[model samples]
Target: MNIDQAISARHSTREYTTQAVDEEVIVRLIGAATLAPSAMNLQPWRFTVIRDQALLDRISREAKACLLETLAPGAQSERFHALLDDEHFQIFYHAPVLILISAEAPGQSVVEDCALAAQNLMLSACAEGLGTCWIGFAQRYLNTPQGKQALNLPQTWVPVAPIIVGHPKTEPAPVAHQAPQIRWIG
Candidate 1:
């Protein structure tokens, strides 16, 4: 698929099949990620792929706990509170793979640079007939000391995106989007 087609097709995939993505396909996607523009061409992002279901489950549990602790009472609302409190709510949505886009070192625009890479990765996945979702709920926990230890990553590596990828159970229907509110000054 072309870039425009991929852009339109890509959405946050929540349900996935049991099949895992091939290593070569993942490598190709990461290649696309590396090609993303960076500040001063400093590609400070690092790729960490996790395929372990047990690990993902543990991370989901811990992350939910962390988020629950940090959120002010009534900040998350009742519905969200129930969801986060549910033990069966997998934050990664049981996807077979998680490609973590992390920053190996600090930079003036490392987070922004990594985010661009993440977008590239997700779009590439869409082109490859795979579904992906950036799991924001997994990001904060993966940056914690315990989370770093679980991944055997240094404290300095900041986890920016917790993107899960896998074969989607069924193609997701497109959701309505609002037009951009533009204000041009020229």
Candidate 2:
């Protein structure tokens, strides 16, 4: 698929089938991620792919508990609270693979670079007829020391994006998006 088609086809896939993604396809997606533009050639991104179901389940539970503990009681917390109330909610949606895009440095640009890499990876997955979703809910817990130990992440690597990839169970409908408000300046 072309870039345009990939971009249009890529969406946040929350549900996936039990089918496993090929290792070669996973490698290709990561290769695409590495090609993303970085600031000053500082390719600070590192990836950790998780395929173990037990680990994924533990991470999901810990992440939800961590989020609940940290959230303040207010309007913003209500949505999260409601989500946590669901007993069967899996943060990664039981995807066959979970890829964490991390950065070695702590800075705004480093974070941006990792995010760019994640976008590239997602698009590549779409082109390969796979589904991908960026799970922000996993971020907070994944950054913690215990979480880092669980994933065997390096001390310097900071988790920036949690993405799940697999074969989609169903195709999502087109999302209605508003046109960007642009101001021309010459």
Candidate 1 clashes: the total is 0
Cα error, residue 26 of model 1, in Å, equals 0.6
lDDT of 1 by residue, 8-69 (tens): 99999999999979999999999999999999998999999999999989889999998877
Distance from true location, Cα of 77 in model 2, Å: 2.2
Q: Residue-wise lDDT of candidate 2 within 1-186, one digit each (tens)? A: 899999988989988999988899999999999999999989999989899999999999999999988888998689889997577998999999999999986876988999999999999999999999999899999999988998989877899999999999999778889999999999
Off by over 4 Å in 1: 75-77
Per-candidate TM-scores read 0.96, 0.96
True lDDT of residue 4, candidate 1: 91
Q: Could you tell me which 10 consecutive residues in candidate 2 have the lowest summed lDDT? A: 79-88
Return the TM-score for candidate 2, rounded to 2 decimals: 0.96
What lDDT does candidate 2 reach at residue 122?
A: 97
Q: Give the local distance difference test score of model 1.
A: 0.92
Q: How many steric overlaps are in each model, in order?
A: 0, 0
